[model samples]
Target: MAHQESSVLQLKQELLRANMDKDELQSQNVDLQRKMEERSQLAAEYKKELTQKEWLIQQLQGKLDESHRKLSEANYQK
Candidate 1:
């Protein structure tokens, strides 16, 4: 009967430790989730900026092509 009581106590202690570990892991998960959300927002902003830059580059390329065409036509007339 004494041995059975000691075993029960040991089981209770193990259960308490497991509960503490679970709480710590849950806290860490929350922190990591918040960081992930922030990183996702930053990435979206960067993608928008990159898209704008690409559009501007395309517009400049169009203007350059137009200038080259006009120059070529003028030289041909000469």
Candidate 2:
């Protein structure tokens, strides 16, 4: 009977340890998820900025081309 009681106590301790480990793992998972979301948001913002810069570059190129054409026309008139 004493051996049986000791076995029961050991089982109870094991169960408690398992529960604690599970809780810790769950908390870590939540932290990782939050970090992933933040990274995704940052990536989206970077993409938006890159697109705006590309558009601005295109506009500048168009203006340069127009100026070149005007200069050529003026020279021809002279």
Candidate 3:
């Protein structure tokens, strides 16, 4: 009877530890998921900013090309 009681005590302790470990893992998983969501939003904002910058660059390039064409024509007339 004493041996059976000892075995039951050990099993109870093990179960407690398992519950604590499961709680800790769940907390960590929630934190990681939140961080992933934040990073995903940041990535999307960066992509939008990059797209706007690319459009501006294309507009500037077009203006530059027009200026060069005008300069070439003026030189040829001279």
Candidate 4:
């Protein structure tokens, strides 16, 4: 029947549209995943730099403390 043919045509169009939408969504998901990986790498680099700076600050503080103690001892002896 003509009505049955029309119904079949509509279903095929709907299926084609759904397939296109699914392909677009998959492409977007892949792009988002790549961006997330880049951000994660950047975050890790920043964390490493921060750790190095903290260690340097600790070393400087230790030297400053030693200098202050030596100065105090000399002054007390005088």
Candidate 5:
């Protein structure tokens, strides 16, 4: 029957549209996952840099303390 054929055609079109939508959503999901990985790597690099800076600051503080101690000793001898 023509009516049955028409119904089948409409159903097929709907199925095709649904498949396209699914493909688009999958692509978007993959993009989001890639961005998340990039951000995670950046965060790790920042953390490493921060740790290095903290170590440098501690080294400088130790040297400053040593200088102050020597200065105090020199003053006491005078």
Candidate 6:
């Protein structure tokens, strides 16, 4: 009877340790998911900003080309 009681106590202690390990793993998983979401949002914002800058660069190049053509025409006429 003493041996049986000792075995039962040992099993209960193992079960408690398993439960604590499971809880810690679940907490870590939640934190990782939250960080992934934040990184995704930041990546989207950066992509949008890059697209806007590209469009502005194109507009500036078009204006520069037009100015160069006008200057050439004036010099040719002189």
User: In model 4, which runs have C-alpha deviations exceeding 4 angstroms?
Assistant: none
Q: Clash number for every model?
A: 0, 0, 0, 0, 0, 0
Candidate 5 residues 1-78, lDDT tens each?
999999999999999999999999999999999999999999999999999999999999999999999999999999
Residue 30 deviation, candidate 5, in Å? 0.9
Tens digits of lDDT, candidate 6, 1-78? 999999999999999999999999999999999999999999999999999999999999999999999999999999
TM-score of each: 0.85, 0.81, 0.94, 0.90, 0.81, 0.82
TM-score of 6: 0.82
Cα lDDT tens digits for candidate 4, 1-78? 999999999999999999999999999999999999999999999999999999999999999999999999999999
- Name the better of 1 and 3 by TM-score: 3
Ranking by TM-score: 3, 4, 1, 6, 5, 2
What tens digits encode model 3's per-residue C-alpha lDDT throughout 1-78?
999999999999999999999999999999999999999999999999999999999999999999999999999999
Give the lowest summed-lDDT range of ten residues in model 2.
Answer: 11-20
Question: Which candidate comes out best when scored by TM-score?
Answer: 3
Model 6 clash tally, residue pairs: 0
lDDT score at residue 32, model 1, on the 0-100 scale: 100
Superposed Cα deviation of residue 10, candidate 5 (Å): 2.2
**Candidate 2 at residue 78, lDDT?**
100
